[model samples]
Target chain A: AQSVTQLDSQVPVFEEAPVELRCNYSSSVSVYLFWYVQYPNQGLQLLLKYLSGSTLVKGINGFEAEFNKSQTSFHLRKPSVHISDTAEYFCAVSVLLRRFGAGTRLTVKP
Target chain B: DVKVTQSSRYLVKRTGEKVFLECVQDMDHENMFWYRQDPGLGLRLIYFSYDVKMKEKGDIPEGYSVSREKKERFSLILESASTNQTSMYLCASSFFFGAIPGSGPEAFFGQGTRLTVV
Candidate 1:
């Protein structure tokens, strides 16, 4: 079985600051990685996905993630964040089924 | 756009009562899943159905059951609702790719149903 570990449970960042949410997975075989964001009282939306291609995957809202095979990590990063970026971020590893991390609550202060 | 809709946004049921959480997807996805969300437990899969009438137990499937009579609809049934089951329930759907389910793409999630079992 595969599992995901999100190093941070909560991250607080000031507005317009850069942020990186770490995600690591344990899988013997190749895996697909994804990032999803859930706003307050809303369902989750796809932030980005790494299926097959370049290691650097850019997603909506100026967010990006790098799939480092050697490190077994797919960390989400954003050059700058805004107040609207405050939400719960989930990192998922897809093998036969998708397993998510505990979740990281990103708080963007004004 | 793909849309996964849960029947209820909020539901409250008494203990020991049989609870049914409905999910419907309009994208004609071949796979549907039921998951429970807790404060620290991101999302634990309860059950998932790959095709009509085929169900698979997920990580946490102790007190949960699922029914999928149709491709777009999947229902999660709580045989006996308990206070411990009071959590946000989410429904998701994904397209079935090649023979390997792992090839399937990212899942689309519903708004989630806040179930309060008291």
Candidate 2:
């Protein structure tokens, strides 16, 4: 079974500031990684995915994540954030079944 | 646009009553999942189906049962609702016909149903 761990439970940042949300996973074999975001009162949307090749994967809303094999990490980063970026973010790992992290709540303050 | 739709946005049910939550997908996905979401726990998979009438237990499937009569429809049932079971329920679908277990396909999620047991 595969599992994900989101290091941070909550993150606060000022608008236009850079931020990073840390994630790590445990698996014996190769796995796929993903980041998803959910706004208040809405469903989750895919932010980005790391299937294979190119450690750096980019997604919508100016979000990107780096897949580090040795470290077992897939951390999400944004050079600059907007108020709209405030949402709950999740990291997931898949082997045969996909498992999600505890989730990180990002609050972008104006 | 591709979509996953849940039957309800919000629901209120009495404890010990049977509850049913429905979901439908139009993207012709081969996999459907039921998840329970709590504030700090993120999403915990309750059950999943890879095909019609094919179901698998997930991480947290102790209190739930599922049915998938048709390819596009998946339903989650709570035999006896409890206070602890009151939480946001999510449905998702993904395409996994020819792909490896964890290699291909991304899941699309429904808007979610907030079920409260009183």
Q: Pick the candidate with the highest TM-score.
A: 1
What digit string (tens of lDDT, one per residue) describes model 2 on residues B6-109? 99999999999999999999988889999999998989989999888989888899989999999999999999999999999999999884554313358899
TM-score to true structure, per model: 0.98, 0.97
Which regions of candidate 1 deviate over 4 angstroms?
A: B101-103
Residue ranges of candidate 2 with Cα displaced over 4 Å = B97-104
Model 2's chain B TM-score? 0.94
How would the docking of model 1 be graded? medium
Lowest summed-lDDT stretch of 10 residues in model 2 chain A?
Answer: A91-100
Which pairs clash in the backbone of model 1?
A: none
DockQ for all candidate structures vs. native: 0.71, 0.64
Q: What does candidate 2's lDDT look like per residue over A1-110, in tens digits?
A: 68899999999999999999999999999888999999998899999998889999999999999999999999999999999999999999977888999999999999
